[model samples]
Target: MSDFLSSTLLFLLQASRMTILVSSAGLLIGFFIAVAIVGACLSHIPWLRRIGNLYTFVFRGIPLLVQLMLAYFFLPAAGIHVPAWVAAVVAISLCEGAYIGEILRGGFLGIPRGQIEACQMLGLPRLDVLFRVEIPQALKLTAPSLINEAILLIKASSLVSVVGVTEITRTAQNIASSTFRPLEAYAAAGLMYLVICGALALAGHYAERRLART
Candidate 1:
């Protein structure tokens, strides 16, 4: 039991490091893609909007496992050689971008029409109005959703192990396989994940309250 605890704890430390790297990369990359997708969806160009909607639909509608597999397997056939870590990040970012884009779009739609009109009345440039007025409100409205999505990203990052990334789940699996103590290893992994998710949830609530107060 002591051996299992020690080994699991050690693996969890490794996993934590990998999880942070992958999750941060996924969220940072996904944020830009999400913004582009939302902008495209909201564009005046019909084809651009359609393309963006299709991107969101395809990514969001498909199972994440399938996306990960396609990235790791099929992309190689197309002459795009991505490392396992890169593939994992790409798959996660693409999947999360779809959902994030929708969240942002919903936030945009939720803005009061009067606010937009007021921006126009102030003689603000179109881009300035969007950046200064619309985006700020949208971000505030979407803060909770963004936090939830980030939690989802953290969980989803575990799936990267299928492609050979040594993330927390992968590390746990390795220890469990060698030690034959799957229960303990997995329980530790779950607890660590819970800690991270809980922390993010609390932070989200605090941010939401601050935003509301302002």
Candidate 2:
């Protein structure tokens, strides 16, 4: 019994590594896409703002599962031919980018107009003001929310199994099928997710404290 549990843990841990890798990649890529989205949304050009809003609307409106299926199945039909991992990451990035974009937009909006006026009065370049002052403050303001979004992303990554990426939930299913221990297998998977998310929460808290001090 002890050996069985240990082996199952090891197997699930292996699969969890894939989960971490994919989720981290998705979040990192999504964050950059989100920055772009926020820029478009906040642009002076009307069409650019509309395009950003449209992107956020479409991605946020569509179900992530549908998005994943479309990426995995429809893309090949359209001659894109991306690998499963690539498809999963792309879908996750797009979906999460929409949400993170909104979060960042909120953060930007929350910044004081006085700060912008001060920068302008000081003859600071627009780009310098935006990159050095606005973006940094926005990021600091949104760090907690972004951390929460990351945790949610990690949980949502279980859905990647449909794209043939063998993450934790899929590994649990396999273990259950072979060992006939569905409860144990799933419980272990749940525990793994808890550990990962808990650790992330702790790290986020530490970062938030550091940001606060700065």
Candidate 3:
């Protein structure tokens, strides 16, 4: 039993590397996409706002599992062949970007009108004001929520298994099938997820404290 448990843990630890890689890639890409979406939604142009709204609605409404399947299967059928990992990352990015964009929009809305007006009155360029003042304040205001979203994204990454990526959940399933110990296999997987998410929460807490001091 000890041997079985030890070996199972080793295998799971190996598979978890893939999970971390995919989730990290997805979150990074999603964050950039979210910035673009927030810009479009906040744009003065009617068409740009409409497009941004449409993107948010469609991506948020669709199930993430369906999106993953479509990215992995449909893209190839449409002649855009991508690796399973690439498809998984892209699907995760698009889905998470929509949610993150909405979160950022709310953060932006929370910013004081007076501060923005002050920047304008001081003759700061729009880009300078946005980058230096608005974005920083918005990020600080939204840090906790953003960390929650990151935790959610890490959990949701299990769905990437369907795309043939052997992430932690997929590895656990495989172990359960072979070892006939579903409980042990799945419990270990759950524990791994808990550790990763707990670390993220701790990091976020530290960041929030630093921001508070500054």
Candidate 4:
């Protein structure tokens, strides 16, 4: 490899590591929020349902970069001192959680009313029905959308570079600055992202097949 290619490879590796870590953490957090939002959406209480809907609308309407900027820049003005990584994670989770919540809500809607009735007739508690009977099927039904969400999460990690997280996009930017070869550096970084997303797409397909077969 030429010197430029070699340096780009090294930088890409470093950036990819951060992408994995940040995406994992953000997804975990988003999953938690998704659960809560799903519960809220399904609640009997009107207030809770409205609150969940409002939350969904607000987060979904805002661009992710704006959310990140608010967390990184505006939060401190309001006395919340968050590190760049923490802010990045929070922003990504909030933005993604809104969409995930909607996906889960769609999954919940796909469940037949008769199924819930069946669980109730069997004397299963509501929570038990949700966890054991409902959510599992919903997950299977929503697997494709969730996998798409995962792909979005992977791409969104690049935005964190703007907040100075030194993730893949940031690394690419740095390499381009030093080597004056934006095309090579950014192109390599794009390829790295493409590979990660392609692998994830395959995993999603395999998971869907397994779920369907079972």
Please give the CA lDDT of all the candidate structures: 0.88, 0.94, 0.91, 0.90
Clashes of each: 0, 0, 0, 0
Ten-residue stretch with the least lDDT total in model 3: 205-214
Candidate 2's C-alpha lDDT? Answer: 0.94
TM-score of candidate 1 on Cα atoms, chains taken together: 0.92
Question: Against the true structure, what is each candidate's TM-score?
Answer: 0.92, 0.95, 0.95, 0.94
Q: Top model by lDDT, which number?
A: 2
Candidate 4: residue 99 Cα off by (Å): 0.2
2 versus 3: better lDDT goes to: 2
Model 3 over residues 104-172: C-alpha lDDT tens digits?
899898999999999999999988988898778888899999999999988999999988999999999
> What is the TM-score of candidate 4?
0.94
- Where is model 2 poorest over a 10-residue stretch in terms of lDDT? 74-83
Stretches off by above 4 angstroms in model 3 are: none
| Model 1 whole-model lDDT (C-alpha atoms) | 0.88
Kindly report which residue pairs in candidate 2 clash with one another.
none
> How far off is model 2, as Cα RMSD?
1.3
For model 2, what is the error of residue 141's alpha carbon versus the real structure, in angstroms, after optimal superposition?
Answer: 1.0
Q: Is candidate 1 or candidate 4 better by lDDT?
A: 4
Query: Mind sharing the TM-score for model 2?
Result: 0.95
Which scores better on TM-score, 1 or 4? 4
The lDDT, on a scale of 0 to 1, for candidate 3 is 0.91
